[model samples]
Structures are given as C-alpha cells and as structure tokens.
Target chain A: MKLLESVGRIVAISRKEIRQLRRDRLTFGMVVAIPIVQLVLFGYAINEDVRHLRAAAVDYANTQNSRLLLADAHASQVIDLVRKASSAEELEEWLRRGEIRVGIVIPADYERRLEDRKRHGRSARPLAQILVDASDPATYGSVAGLLNLPPPERPGIQPPRWRYGSAISGVSNPPPTFEARPFYNPERRSAVHIVPGLVGVILTMTMVLFTSVAIVRERERGSLELLITTPMKPVELMVGKILPYVLIGLIQVGLVLGVGALIFRVPLRATPQDTIVAALVFITASLTLGLLISTIAKTQFQAFQLTFFSFLPQMLLSGFMFPFDAMPRPAQWIAELMPLTHFLRVIRGILLRGARVVEMRHEIWPLAVFALVMLTLAAGRFRKRLD
Target chain B: MSESAEQVIRSQGLTRRFGSLVAVDHVDLEVPKASVYGFLGPNGSGKTTTIRMLCGLLEPSEGKAQVLGLEVPKEAEGLRRRVGYMTQRFSLFEDLSVFENLDFLGEIHSLKASHRRSRIDTLLERYRLADRRKQRAGTLSGGQKQRLALAAAVLHEPELLFLDEPTSAVDPENRRDFWESIFQLADEGTTVLCSTHYMEEAERCHLLAILDHGKLVANGTPQQLMDDVDATVVEIQTEDPRRVREQLAGMTGLLSLAQLGNRLRLLLHREVENPVWQVEEELDIDAGATVQVVRPNLEDVFVVVTRDEVS
Candidate 1:
C-alpha cells in the first residue's frame, strides 16, 4: 500500500510535466525540429574525401611527356589544373595566394630522361618535383598520393622495373602492393561515420540543455517552493520530471536514425535490441548530467551558460570531429571523462561496426557509471528547502 | 499537555538563521485550530521565513517546532500532505490551464480519481474559475490567478493552510474576495496561517503576530493588540498637514506621525501629559486646526510595536 502511494505521486508529477510540455508549443517544436535540421545540415556539409582540389603546374618541359604527366594528374580526379605557370615563382605565388593546393614542376630534361632510360635500361631517375601546401593535412594527403603516381603510358618507354627484383624471382620478390580496403565504409563517406555519432551528439545537446533548466526555471519562478510544500520526495520528483523527456529523447533518436537511414543510407549494423540498450544508456547519462547542472545552478540563465560551456568540451574532445588517437595524452585523458566520448564509441560501434553489447562493455560500462554517479549527485543536491 | 490538543501548530523558540543573519528569531506560538492567524510585518522582517519553518519547508537553526502534532524536519514529509501552502508569488505552473493545475495538485495529494474530479469541480465553482478553466494560468488576470492559486492550494482539503502574502499581487477588491474565500475555508474547520503587510488584512484576522527584524514584537487578537499598545493616538486636521508633520517630527514622547490627506495621525508615548494638548501645542494649532484623541487601530499598534526597531 505504501509502495502504491509512492507510485501514485510519481505518476502525478509526470502527468503534470506532460501537460506543461504539451502547452509549451515553442519548446515542443524545438524538441522535434532541431534534430531533423541538424542531421540534414551536418550530414551533407562534412565530407572527408577531398576532391577537385585546384593545382598549378610549372611545366618547363613543355614537351609531350610533361603534358602527358600533367594530363594524368588532372585525369585522376584528385587535382584540377586551374592555371599553367611559366616559372616556379608563379607556382609558388599561386600556392601562397591559396588559389591552388598542389604545384607540379617538371624539369626541362624530362623527355631526355625517358630516352636515356630506354637506351641504358635504368639510369638516374628523372627529377619531377611536386610542391604541395600541406597546411590542411586531410586534403594534402589525397593530393600528394595522386601526384606521386607514375606518368602516363608511352610506346618506347617501359615502366620502371621493381627495385628489389621481379615477382617471379624466388630469392627476393618486389615489395607487395600496399592495398588497403576499409572494412565497413569502403567509400569512406564522412556521413556514414558522422551520422551515427550525430545521434549521440544531438541527444546529448538537446537532452542536457533542456533538462538543465527544468528545475532551475521552477525555482526562479517560485513554483519549486510550492512543490516542496507537498509530500513529494526528491527522488520521485526527479524521476517524474525526467520521464517525459526520456520518451522525447527516444523519439529524437528515432527521427535522426530514420533520416540517417533514408537520406544518407547509413547502415544499422547492430540488432534492434543492442541499439535500444545503447540509446537508453546514453540518454540516461545525458539527462542525469542535465539534472546535476540544474541542481547546482541558481537560475535558468546560469543553467543555460553551464550547459553551453559543458557542451563545447563534449563536441571537441569526444572524437566526434577529430580523431581521438591524434589528440595529446592529457586531452585524451580528459576525453575519457566525457559521457559523449564513451557514447560515441558505443553508437558508432553499434551502427557502423556491428558491435554487440557484449563486445562494447568497455564503452557501455563508463556510460552506466556516469549515469549512476551523476543521478546520485543530482538527487543529493536537490534539497526540499528554498535555501 | 491537554492544551496542546487545542493548538494545531505549537512552537517553542523556533528560529532560523542564514549565516550571520537571523531570519527568524526564537518565536513561541500556539495557533489554535479553526482560527485565522495573521503574520504582519514589513518586507525582510522574517514573516515568510517563519511561515516556511512552520510549513516544514525550512529547518530551524536554533529551536524546534511541532506542526500538526509531529516533530518538524524529521516528520516534515508526513506533515506535508496534511498542510497546503500558497506562496507570495503565483507559483502555479503558468503553462498549465486552471483545471490542469488543480488536477495535478489533487493527484499529488493522492486523492482518488472520483474524489479528485468532484473536489476540483467544486473548487472551480467556489473560486468562480469555472469559466476560465481552460485558460492558461499565466495569461489570467491577477485576480483570476489568485483564485486559481487558492483553489489549487485547497484541492486536497488540508487540515491547515499556510498563505505567504497570497494576496500581495491582487487589487483591493480582489484581496477582499480572496479573504472571503479564506474565511469560508476557516469556517469549515480548517486552520489558516497567512502573512501580510496590509494593516486592514491583519485587523480582520482572529489573531495577529507582529515581527520586526526577525523577532516577534507583539501577538494578540486585533482588539487585544490595539488595547495593549502603550501609546495614545491623536488626529489633527489642518490646512497644511505636512507643516504640522514637520512641527511634530521631533516632539518629545512622539512615537510616529502619519499624514493622511489633510489629517495628521500621531501616536504618542503613554507617558505624555494630555496627548491631544501636546500635539496641538507642538503643531501650533489655532482655530483652523482641530486636535482630538482617537481610538487605537491596528496601524497604531503596528507603529507602537515596530517603532523602536526602525529607529
């Protein structure tokens, strides 16, 4: 009987919260609209595979061989030759102005090297220099790889022989071709990777931001004092207040994932059960973080600022945009503390890597621990007194 | 111990402090059941703080209180369902409609569905909010919102109700109507404890407690408080009341001077010799002005009790 009364109080608070949420049309719209807009905007904007990068060529060897090499570079689709420079100075000038990312310089004796190689069978290698603006490493790597490819095919000039020996030679064969095939995303579509992580990001952003102000707003408006005068327990109030948002969080995840599947063709590699479990754990962590913030903040504006400040660290250090392995040791350690950092791994593992729950214990455990600890802390701070 | 049964709220040296500031000094109260008790004080005089302590919303720093025969801070959870609180600010969920707010409170009070519906409907009719049941609480007028807050407070029909300046935002007419509703509740055997700075409101209460700087300076029925004030009131009508007020500002044995239009009401210390003659002589009243001894009212009582603290 006592348990029934407790449940009744919780249900009462939840019903009130739901009624308020329904009446607040602006917040209701935000709950549904933000996810769709963010998914579409960020999904198409982030692309990792750099293409159509502009290049300037200083072809002093204006011969057929030099033109052929330039043509091959342009044909690879990685570099677009926007201008032909008369000297190395012009190439450097174009690069400095940011007009082109790659600059190719072929020497005046470029055709002679082929002729000498044809007669002598392997003389000193011809000097064909490629100057790349390695400022943006993401785009520079693709440009450099295409620039290093062998020149276009010729009638008399044979392809360079293997450095060590022929493949048929038993003693020492040539170095094996370094062929790399990406496992899940062979095309390396950034959306395929980013859209999954976005599910966690959007949930964290909205859930934490929305719940962080829930209690603080009541306190500022003086409604919390009325609530405290009732027989409601702190735990009951917290659970009831967050339960409606939990459903909202689930609906948000569904909308994002649905759009991700329909528009980006993002594959859901894990089963439905694993996905649900992962989403629940992540949602709990985010909501608990919001509750903790609300308990610490004295007003709604403070809650907003705290949510924004905490949100930036999650986005930057959670490996959502940058590679975690590339971060410094201290930064990586800080990243380990964020729930988003662990949730990103769980979500990405489940959606892109087809990882099961058992295999994702490392990521899932940290999120569970975060949810538990933050929830306890939030409840501890939520006093019944106005002070 | 038998007298404790007649008192719905009993306290001995109940106090609360915020750091170095004592918000509520040691106050002993015995509020009998079925009576309207008023807490009268200016802003920051600890009236709200004292009400909060009795409602179990705050813990006392130095002393303890027993509300509804239960020890506070430990039995506060149990006492909550038995008492209703209405804050100075309209604390109902502004986004919710009138009906929704009452329904929510009814549910929190753990009323059965059938009983909750009936009680809500009755309250809506009683508070004259049936027509505005669908309107959002935030958009309602000050009077309408006050009624809604009162209805929500009494939805569960608690044994005791604590109203913290509940009518502060309403106009005079609305405050009158709100008091009528409170009186109706009191007549139905519910004990009420409300705080207000309005003198007329305190005068209507069966008992009043005057607080100043976190201390209870006076407590009694309205007539008892007026008769207990150690001062005499004199009203002087002159062409220039402000001039009269200026002349009487520093007069010996003068407690307070309030100018109401063309009349200056003066409270004088009881030791004064012939208070009316003293005021007339100090203000240089001639044939144009009149000085007469008047009956003591709640304002005179308030002035007499809180005057020393202000100085």
Candidate 2:
C-alpha cells in the first residue's frame, strides 16, 4: 500500500513536469524540434569525398608520350585536367592560388630518354614530377601516392618480359597501363563521413541542455518545497522527470533520420528500430549526465557554464570534426572518458556501416554503466529535502 | 472531540540547531484536535522551524515530537500523506491550470478519479475560483493564487493543515475570507496549526503560542494573553506629543507608548492618581486635544510579551 502511494505521487509529479515542459516553447523547440532540423542539415549537406581534383599539366617536352600520359590522367575520374600550362611557373601559380591540387610537369628530355633506353638495351626512368599542395594533409597525401605508382604493364606481358623494339615510333608510343582504383569513399565526400557522427552530436547537445536545467529551476522557484514534502522517492522522481526528455529525444532522432533519407539521400543503412534503440540509449546516458550536472550546480547560470565547459571538450576530443587517430595522445585519452566518444562510434557504425546490436554491445554496456552510476549519484544528491 | 483523546501534535523539548544557533529551542507545545492553533512571532522567531518539524519536513535535534499521533522522523513519510502544508509563498506549479494543480495534488494523495473530480469541482465552487479554473496558476492575481494554493492543499481533506503565514501578502478583506475558511475547517473537526506575524489574524485562533528568540514566552487564548499583560492603555492627544513620548518613556509606571496618527497611546501598569491630569498639567496641548482610556488589543499584549522577553 505504501509503495502504491509513493508511485502515485511520483506519477503526479512527473505529469506536472511534463505540463511545464510543454508550456515552455523555447525548451520544447530546442529539445524536440531542433534535432530534426540538425539531422536534415547534417545528413544532406556534409560530404567527405575528395574526387574530381583539378590539375594543371605543364608538358614542356611537346612529345606524343607526354600527350598520351596526360590523356590517361584525364581519363581517370580522380583528376580533372583543368588547364594546359606551357611552363612550370604557371603550374606553381595555380597551386598557390588554390586553383589546382596537383600539377604534372613533363621534362623536355623525357621522350629523348626513352629513345636512348630503347637503343642501349637498358630501362629508362622518366623525370616528370607530380607536385601536390601539402596544406590539406589528408587529401594531398592520397593524391601524392596516386601520382607516384609505377605505370601499368601492357597486355599479355609476362613477368620480367620487355623488348626494346625499334618500331616504337620516335619514343612517342609508350606501354599500356592499368587504372588506379579507389575503395570505400570513391567520391571522398566529407558529408558521408560527418553525417553519421552528426546524429550523435545533435542528440547529445539537446538532451543534456534541457535535463540539466529542469531540477535547478524548481529549486530556485521554491516549487521544490512542494515536491520534496510528498512521499515520492528520489529515484522515482528523477526517472519520472526524465521520461519526457527521453521520448522527445527519440522523436528528434526519427525526424532527423527522415530528413536524412528524403533530403540528403543518406542511405538508411540500418533498420529504423535499431537506429532508434541506439539513440534511446545515447539519450538515456546523456540525461543521466545532465542530472549529474544538476546535482553539482546551484543555479541555471552555473549549470549552463558547466554544461558548455563539458560540451566543448567532448566536441573537440570526440573526433566529430577531426580525426581521433591524428590527435595528440593526451587529447585522445581525454576523449575516451566522454560518453559522446562511445555514442559517436555507435551511431556511425549503425547508421553508416549497418552494425547490429551484438556488434554495438561494447558501446551499449559502457553507456548503461555510465547511466547507472550517474543516475544513482544524482538521485542521492537530489533527495526530497536538501541535505 | 473527547478531552481524553490525544492531542493532534505533541512535542517535548523539541530543538533544532543550525551549527551553534538554536533555531527551535527546547519548547513543548500541544495542539488539540479540531482547534485552530496560531504560532505568533516576529520574523526569525522559530515559528517556521517549529512548523517544519510538526509537518515532518525537518528532524529535531534533541527532542521527541509526534504529529497526528505518529512519532516524527520515524513515521514522517506515513504522516505526510495525512498532513497538508502550505508554505509562506505560493508554491504551486505555475505552468499548470487551477484544475490541473488540484487534480495533481489529489492524485498524489491517492484520491480516486471520481472522488478527485468531485473534490476539485467542489473546491473551485467553494473558493469562488470556478470561473478562472482554466487560467494558468502564474497568471492568477496574488489573492487568487493564495486561494488556489489553499484549494490544492485541502484537496485531500487531510486531517491536519499547516499554513505558514498564508495571508501575509493578502489584502485585509481576502484575509477575512481566508480565516473564515480556516474556522469552517475547524468546525468540520480538522486540526490546524498556522503561524502569522499579523496580530489581528493571530487573535482569531483558539490558542496562540507567542515565540521570542526561539523560546515560547507565552501560550494562551488572545483575550487571556491580553489580560495576562494587566495594563491600561490611554490614548493622548497633545500639542507636543513627541515631548510627552520622551517624558512618558522615563516613567516607571508606563509600559509602552504607540503613536496613533497625531496622538500617542500610553500603556500603564497601573492607573496612577490622575495620570491624564498629570500629563495635561506638564505637557502643552491645544484646547481641542482629547485624552481617552480604552481597552487593550492583541498588539498591546504582543508588545508586553516580547518586551518582557527582551528585558
């Protein structure tokens, strides 16, 4: 009988909290409406693929060999032959002005070296260089590797089989070669990589922002006096207060997923049910974190400051905008403690790679543990009466 | 209500200490069933602390207190369901409508749906808040908000109600209506323990416990407390009332002097030989100035009681 009464009180209090949430237009919009808009923006707008890089070719040799090599580079989808510069100066200028990512320079002696090698019974090495702008390290690194590979072997050519045929017309006729193949991100769009993590970032920000402020507002308004006087247990009150935010978090995830599929054309790699369950877990963990923040904060302003402080580290360290592996070791270790790290991994795996629950159990267990510890501490701190 | 029945609230040597300061000292108080007990004190007089202890919100440091026949701190949770408490401020959920606030509290009290609906409707009608039932609590005027808070507190019809200065900010006319409701509740056999700074409101209680500096200096009916002071109050209108006030302060027989508009009311422990004649002979006054002796009120008793406590 006593338990029934306590549960009833908790429910009553939770109902009142839900009413207050609905009444607040700004909080409701931020917690529920903004996530949908963010999901759409992230899913459709961000692209990570780095294909179709513009390149300027300086063919000083003026030979058929240089022309054929240029044609082959143009035939491939990775590089676009934007301009034919007659001098290396023009090529360097284009690279500095950000007009081109890679520049190919064919030396004047390139066709003459091949002809001499054909007559002397020795293989010749070309002197042409692929100059790349190293400012964007990741993109420039891949382009440089593509430029350095050995030429493809001719058809029906056995291993270690080559002939210096005098019929190779004036060093213009070069051997055939194979095309470069790019795996995974064929287009190298940043959106494809970032959208998956954006889902996690958006949900984390919204759930934490609202849950952190709700309890402190009651304390400031003195409504906490009325609530604490009732027979409701601390955990019961916390859970009841958090249920609405969890539901809203799910709604936001669904809205964003819909926009991603319809507007951004991001594929629904996983089933809707799986994606929702993952998002629910993420929100539950984040809500507990919010409660933890409320436990230590004295007012809404203090809560805002603490929340932003925590959020900045998570955003920078979680590799949402930067590569985690490339970050300094100390920074990477710091990111490991933030729940957003696990959440981003889970969301990206499920949304982009279509990971299953068993595959995501590693991420799920940590979140569950974090939620448990935070919720327990928060309940103890936010008892019916102040300690 | 049988005389042999246990008091609704009984405490022996109840004390709550905050660090070195004793907020509620070793004070014992008994609240009879169906009686309106008023705790009268100025600000910081331990009235709020005592009320909090009685309502099971705070634990006493060195005393035993029973609320509604249940030992406090042990049966606090169980007793909470039976006691309704209204804080000094209107602490209702501001975002909810009047009907919703009442219904929510009713639900917490575990009132059945049918019973809750009828109780809310009846409360609205009785409080004359039915027309504004749909208005948000934040939108209500101060008086209406107080009415709503009271309505919500009594929704469960708890056996005991603790109202901590419920009418401090309320207008005089509304205060009268609120006291009428309290009296009506007592008539229905519900125990009430309220605290207030307004002596007139304190005068309405069946019993008054005057606390000073965390101690209960006096406890009795309003008339009995006034009679306990045993002084005569004389209202004097003099041309130089300020001089009279100063001269009156040095008199041993005079208890207190309260300014009333352009005149001063002098309280005397005894009616000396022609005191008004003595005042008129010594102090200058216009011919139209009049002097009259009147009965004492609650404020006079309060002044004497608190003054005795200070000295």
**TM-score per candidate, in order?**
0.82, 0.78
> Over the full model, what C-alpha lDDT does candidate 1 score relative to the true structure?
0.82
TM-score for candidate 2 (chain B): 0.92
- Going through the candidates in order, the fraction of native interface contacts each one reproduces equals 0.89, 0.56
Task: Compute the interface RMSD for candidate 2.
Answer: 1.9
| lDDT per residue as tens, model 2, A105-221 | 877886665455454322345446666543333444456445533333233532343443344336554432222222223454455556667777877787787778887787777
- Report interface Cα RMSD per prediction: 1.2, 1.9
The deviation in Å at residue A294 for candidate 2 is 2.5
Model 1: CA > 4 A from native: A45-176, B246-250, B283-287
Q: Residues A33-139, candidate 1, lDDT per residue (tens digit)? A: 88988888778544245666777788887887778888887888777888989998887655544456677888888777645434443233544777665433345
- Which ranges in model 2 have alpha carbons more than 4 Å from their true place? A1-11, A36-185, B1-5, B19-21, B230-232, B253-255, B268-293
Best-fitting candidate, scored by TM-score: 1
lDDT of 2 by residue, B1-311 (tens): 57536589889999999899998889899889999999999999999898887776778888999888789877887876788888898888889998998888788778889999998999999998999999999999888999898887788788999999999888999999999999999999889999999988999999999998888988989889887766777788767667677666666577788897778887777656676665555455544457777778888888877888888
Write candidate 1's Cα lDDT for B1-311 as tens digits: 57769799888898999999999989989899989999999999999999888887888997888889999877888888889888898999888889888888887788899999999899999899999989989999999998998888888889999999988888999999999989999999999999999999999999999999999999999999998888989988889877777788889987788889988888888899888777767766353689999999999998888987667
